[model samples]
Target: MFSASRGFVPLLAAAALTGVLLGACQPQGAEAPPAATAGGPVRILSAKGLNPQAGEASPQGRLLIGRGKDYTPLNEDPKALFDKLEGSMAERRKTGWAIVEALLEPQKLTLDGKTYDVPLWHTWYEGMSANPEVDQKIKLFIAQLAACKADADCHKSRAEIAHEVMAQSGTDKNLVRSLVSANLTQVLKQSEGFDRGNPEDELGQGFTLFSPSFVEHVLAQAQGIETCSNKIPWNQAPPSAGQFSPCVEEFPRSAVMVKTNWDQIDGASPKVSAHATDAAAVTAVLKGGTWPKPTLEPVDPSGIYTVQTTDGKLFGLKSIHISTKDTREWIWITLWWSPKPDEDFGQDRPASLARFNGGVWSHYKMCVTTAFNETDPKPWGSYETAQPALAAAIKASYDGAVEQRNPAPYDKVTTWCSNPNLEHHTGNGRTNCIGCHQYSLTWNELKERPAYFSDTYAASMAAEYPQYGRARRRANFPAEFAWSFGMEFQEQIKTAREDQGFSW
Candidate 1:
């Protein structure tokens, strides 16, 4: 969910973010040391990074600031800086770092100078149904069909047998059909409505794509979650449909899903709204298209959008959520996207790939949070290509590397994370992507916590957040105000004073 000025509003940002009351929370003590800045303009070095104590020959020791007198430390408080990665995003856009293009693009990674290509998601990922325990469920479901078609039961139609399984497991019939025909091509085809081979079919705009980390979080959590469809209020919906994910008989967790803001006037339905319902007042101000700011164009007749470069666009504003297998953490994600520029930066329509540095658009930008709960103050905010030159200058000063030039001809390559939310945020202070997600959790289960996840994959670049149980986990604090993951993790530690007793 995002709140910014210029008449921007998400359809139901809070719908998925707000809800619940687990218990009181306390921020981590400053005594604890800083962890990975996660993903941002900063770098995560093995030892003292950049200008540890500030570089230079001054008696003041190291020159802490890389840019001018005022700048953020590129190598400290990784959790916080991981919140902003301007240059990296530009780099990521070119490399497919965790965007949907990752699936469509040919990927390569240089490790120690030897390049290794990444595997395709359809081949690399297996849904929970592939797990031994889950496989048993599938097998049992199959046996039901075999019995229905047995010699004596030849009178039973295949549809009859199919219905039996659906009726018995309370699953979606279409899902059953999909399982029976599941495979790489089929999965990819079902995931989106566009044609992969046709340039015209391109999403036409930057859209959100789920990363493998978010997928890992969902499947891992499926291990503990059960069908909420069978629960009290959830049961009122329909079979195979639950209040939470794992509610359906099974979800194709490995199937990477991406979506566009169809509510916009430029989307599939040009007549429909493309923003949050609660903020119609904001949309009224932008009746005339915005210039300088990224402009929006419809990708499909269905209302999906493709906006300008990462400068100022929320390509795919989506999130995914799931409880941890231990029921102690809530793995959720916040996703953003930038419309890849036309090959020639929109100088001409249908720009030739050969004329551009890369065959596709010039760049894309995105950010995400680690699988953290309520306690994480800094969810990973990675990428802003526009400010890369500045970031690189700072990095060069600290790392003592030569000033890097754009290997490609495009200029957006030098951008930095702009923190879209900050544009409309009331203050001038730089806000990270996690700023909004931080409110995505609460106490007492009085309401529901939204599940945030990604939608696409990058061909090469991937902005990765630490996994569950990693030492680099973000901190918790400001008791009484908890995050989804923190609240979930410490749920069992509740005490009378609304303090202490947390199982940790």
Candidate 2:
């Protein structure tokens, strides 16, 4: 899986997705976008669009998300990101997160009479300890395995794997401590496990052994940060040019997912949530003060707003050329949350999640990609529209002559959850999540870059999207944006280092 044989791809069998190209990007063939029944699901394309390039999976696809038959494909740069994100969210909601589970190869560890499905990090000790005594025992274990393989009637015992190690240590106590505690030592902390399959490990799964203190820090930061939320229209689209028309900041709290004493589910109340996570407390902790003690309200359930495509067609599929295997529409349900109960956002929160394509992007319709109900009537800001002035300010600030926060870097951070799973494989496509800009820690990183808040940068971003000359995403976004895993790592590292009185 590490090498490029299987496209350098890992095991992804559990998804509705057949296979990913990851070669040259999936290219869109010459064809009009497919059409959904006026009120039906959109039609999906076949998976024949794979083009294997030298070192990249160049998937060129356009998911039709607009009016029936007259689909707007999300094939271009900037707008593509938006539409793709929405598409991915929708897919996840459709599949109830089987797509997410596909990303993980959970370890089946047998310890004591009970088995624990430990995080990947704990698997490190299952191999050789690099000690001769241990290696000899490992040899014996291998021999036993071979003998059993030769005997069709024989079954391998789970404890047999642990025997060699436990025998040397005399008890399971030392082994358990070493596996959990010693593994955290600085040297081992930097092992291959830390970086391997990062995309999967960072899916907000709450599997990592996060420090108690770090979790608190997360809640604190989230509490102080203001919130910006938008509810999907129950009957119509928001008026924004991006297709999210007539959107507003506030919706009934029912629009937010309800948590139970037992678990957290991802829908408005009535239809038992398709996606459920027992880690509601953790999610609330991560959400910080915004949730306000964040307990799930009584089952006095809020209702759900189902997204039904006109003509039973998947606008996403019609707009793009992709695998017919991919599902067209999900049994989609939406929930939005924000800290501002009073419904006022005055630059207090990073709205990394919402954008209306109201800025320079507003002028281009075909290039603007978005879910029909996710955006607002006008998401653009004055700063994003100021070209010459913004461009000039950016040049001056980047050159180091001026320290300007004048435009004052401000972007909203929106979160999304979905099922069915978007075919984009960066992460488990089906799940709750923050916006991509914040997902990668890019928003935080961009703040550190020069003149990032200037209008020029916004224009540059718009240019990379469809309305402008949509170009491939610039490298800077990943190099800097830190979300999910990045956020955790940063906070954990700082906390650990400070506690050590300046140890790296």
The candidate that achieves the highest TM-score relative to the unseen native structure: 1
**Cα lDDT of all candidates, in order?**
0.22, 0.22
Model 1 alpha-carbon drift over 4 Å, by segment = 1-101, 106-260, 263-431, 438-440, 444-504
- For 285-371, candidate 2 gives per-residue lDDT tens digits of 222211121222322111111111112111110010010111111112222221121121111111211111101111110111123
* lDDT by residue for model 1 (1-504), tens: 111111211111111001100111111221111221212221111111111122223211221111101111123243333333222323223222233333323223222222222222211212322111222223343454345445573676533443343334222111111111111112221123433343422122212222333332322332122112112232132232221222222222232323222122223433311211111211221221111122343332111212111111122221111111111111122222224322111112222221111121222223222222212221112211534332332232212101111122211112111122112211111112232222222121222332121110111111111110111112321111112223221221122112321111
Give all TM-scores, in the order shown: 0.26, 0.22
**Clash number for each model:** 90, 80
Model 2 / residue 245 / CA error / Å: 32
User: Model 2 misses residue 350 by how many Å?
Assistant: 34
Query: Candidate 1: deviation at residue 151, Å?
Result: 27
TM-score, model 2 to reference: 0.22
